[model samples]
Target: MATDIPSPDARPARSGRRSGDSTTRTDILVAARTLFGENGFTKTSMRAIAAEAGVDVALVSYHFGNKRGLFSAVMEIPGDPVLRVTTAAAGPREDLGRRLITTFITLWENDDTGVALRAMLRSAVNDEGAATAFGDFASGAMMPAIATTTGLSTETVRAIGSCIFGLAVMRYLIRAEAFTALTTDDVIEQFGPRLQAIVDADT
Candidate 1:
């Protein structure tokens, strides 16, 4: 009879590989985000992301199709707040502020949203196209609805938009310790009325 035994390192190596595939995908995204933030979308390439991630170029395409798709995935956040707010606002003008703030806060509390938000802030700082896209999404979709509900002029609506976006920046992007550390209820308490004030302001 003959007995064979695997090396001590073999089991650990195999165990590491059990999650290697998924970890590779995550690595690609992280590398992509860093590259995109540093170089902007136009200059950052699939090849570069793969190189940074230490993965094959084919893996990038296989997972995300192209740069745009990969960027979209990297930018995806939890809760479709844009859609939800638009849908909810379609029915009536009243209750818009509360609903919008509630939805926005709920979404921001999630990990996915935090990841997307960090990417968005970095991209906006580095990429002109990303800044334009973010601005358009805010003014076209969110601001107009809030303006309609509150009967504010476009300029006032935009001012309110700035305030809301500023809060996100201060809290998340800048990681203003005070703002970031605030509990959900504390955030609502501090900003809820102010947000309502913006919506209800006469301009």
Candidate 2:
């Protein structure tokens, strides 16, 4: 009789999963992305996202590990954005705008995460909730880092962020004739100094 036992510890965890987990995970991602876009990661709560997704906070934690992890999962960011900005911030202060804008645009244009972001932005235009979310992340999360990196004040950052947002909406989202007529390089040349001025003002 001593030869017949397998411990619970020895069992595979995956064997215990319900078929509904896939749907739950997707639900969590959708809800988290919306909340994060609207309120930013620092302000959105796991409980709030879970409640929006019709799940428990425990399930959200189990799926994404933590708030930071949830944000990364929602955005499909390759690395922590703070670190990404810090690394990109390293070099001449003069080149900061070009570097930052180029990097930011590249991420939004990439095939993998960019595709998801594009779809989300399209949805955002027609939906108030989506627009709130997009606005929150862009102004709250994205601008702060650029402000820090450029030694600019928060107010200046907001000004710079507005310019970038307009560029994004015109070029990528709305496909406005004015922005679309200019090449990426042309935009960078024309607008990069406007961004650089915020940093220059600080110095």
- Number of the top candidate by lDDT? 2
Off by over 4 Å in 2: 1-20, 30-42, 50-59, 72-83
Q: What's every prediction's RMSD, in angstroms?
A: 13.8, 10.0
TM-score of each: 0.55, 0.69
Q: Please write out the lDDT profile of model 2 over residues 106-181, one tens digit for every residue.
A: 6666787567656665766887765675566666666777667767778877776677667878888988999889
lDDT of 2: 0.67
lDDT of 1 by residue, 1-203 (tens): 01012222211211122223868889878876666555555456677677667776678878876665676666564344355556644544445556556666766776767677667777776776566545554555557766565566888667656766787888877889988898887777777677666666654
Error of 1 at 29 (Å): 14
RMSD of 1: 13.8
